[model samples]
Target: MQALGFEVLWKGKNFARLMGGLWVALRISLIAVGISLVAGVLMGALMTRKNPVVKALTRLYLETVRIMPQMVLLFLAFFGTTRWFGWNLSGETASVIVFALWGTAEMGDLVRGALESIPRHQYESAAALGLDGKQSFLYVILPQTLRRLLPQVINLVTRMIKTTSLVLMIGVVEMLKVAQQIIEANRMKVPNAAFGVYLTVLVLYFLACWPVSLLAKALEKRWS
Candidate 1:
């Protein structure tokens, strides 16, 4: 009986605020993903090296990230750091830092696996073509590695976007926070507003993420 259009009309301004919060979430996710990509590529390259010390360090970092829950990491970064070190970190900043760390660890592992999966003969072929270390990587190795990495990296991006919702716990006031606020304000008048608002949020997230998922699938199919 409750039409979607009616709900929209009733809470139009709140809907606009939700969009603004979504923009905040998108911005944070983008910055975190960018940092993660660069740091991850470097860490992945290091992980592939034969140096034991380098391998150990990278392994430790990867494991630590993998073992910890993201919420716990967020808390540590936002609350624990401020308490222990007297560092004034904003919720948004802490969320970015935590996500960047997590994404970097995952991406590093993906890159390492992709690089190591390259056949031994590929390296031999590159060297036989008179390619030096840098040339081999740039001209021969990296292109293929990128192909393998593209799909997985795109998937990681979607994950980061979804995970940014957790930032609300630390008072980042992203889309979920906006939704909560709207629900509270309209609880008395629009009894079913929670369903409509949350459904809208779900649709927004799906709209944002579904394209990336499709792109990943397309790339995977093409590369496969």
Candidate 2:
């Protein structure tokens, strides 16, 4: 085990540190995901409207998120914003902000797509049933929209989980960063620790994400 570098994980509190780091990453992503879902639903509903101002603003936001790298966004939020706005944001806070921005954009588009995918006949049918616009949306449209939206949303959860690794770049001591710390500490003693450490991180991430992925798949299958 020492030769293979697995024993290094047993030395002191290294394994516990890794678990703590994983929680940090999850906490950031889950918080951002929660914020995105609420805001994105509102943005998406607005996107379906014919308001020119809303269109322009939503397009700008969506496009900016699409064009910018997540890393650049992280740096902009963590480093640039503190200087520009004089707001002292912690790394975890900055990470949550950046990921929330990114998630909101992506989720907005997904919501818009889900909303638009509903057939015109469905609306007409709801009207034919003497349903008012609000009633129709609540009883008919919302149920269908949620069905289509949920699988994609679950998929987004997994994406966010994996992407949380990028938070390390902004000095958030997430799982990857903790792995690096462990490896760096034991470098002289375990030359091959990097591989084992990274492999463990990879496995942990896969374990974290795989169940979410499976849920998304099951949802798509059940709803398809």
Candidate 3:
């Protein structure tokens, strides 16, 4: 019991507090995902354009996001923006902004991939059905694009949820931050609190992510 360390959860409101912390992480990720989905779709549509200027700009944004470590982006959003722009961004807000940026880039790439995966014949078929350009896209292209993107989007959301753990470093009071607090508070009373608490944390994360993971896999299998 001491070695596994879960007993700490039996005390006070520790477990409840951990659940609240998890909600915080989920809230941030959900909000970020919402923004990313809308913006990413636009960015992805733009990416399919033939203009070199737009392509270059999108490519630059994608490469910049890929090249920069997310930790650095978090630090910049939380600290650097406050210093340079005098914006009093809270840790949670900064976490959301950073994550939204990351998710946007990721979702954009996925959308682009999904859009590109459509065969040229689909468009011609839509036209043969007497569908105009907008109707053709709305009825044919959009459905197919969404079908391809669905599984990947589920996977992306799971990644975003897990990545929310990093927000704790910026003092976002998330599950990991709560776990640390619980361990530190019980250091003397529960010598193995760290191990048990962290183990529990792992389980909580897996529980939260598992359903979505299963859905993504099922989608990939059924849709593939």
TM-score leader: 2
By lDDT, the best candidate is 2
Candidate 1 lDDT for residue 34: 93
Residue-level lDDT of model 3, residues 1-224, one tens digit each, is 76767899989999999999999998999899999998988888888889999999998998888689889999999999989999989999998998898889888999899989999999999899899988987889977897889878988888899999999888899999999999999988888899888888898889888988788778778777
Number of clashing residue pairs in every model? 0, 0, 0
Q: In the order shown, what is each candidate's alpha-carbon RMSD?
A: 2.0, 1.6, 1.8
The residue-by-residue lDDT of candidate 2 on 1-224, one tens digit each, is: 56569878889999999999999999999899999998888878878888899899999999999799999999999999888998889999999998899999999998899989999999999999999998998899877988888878988888999999998998899999999999999999898898888989999999888887787778778878
**Candidate 1 deviation (Cα RMSD):** 2.0
- Candidate lDDT (C-alpha), each: 0.88, 0.90, 0.89
TM-score of each: 0.92, 0.93, 0.92
User: Per-residue lDDT for 176 in model 1?
Assistant: 89
Provide the lowest-lDDT 10-residue window in model 1: 3-12
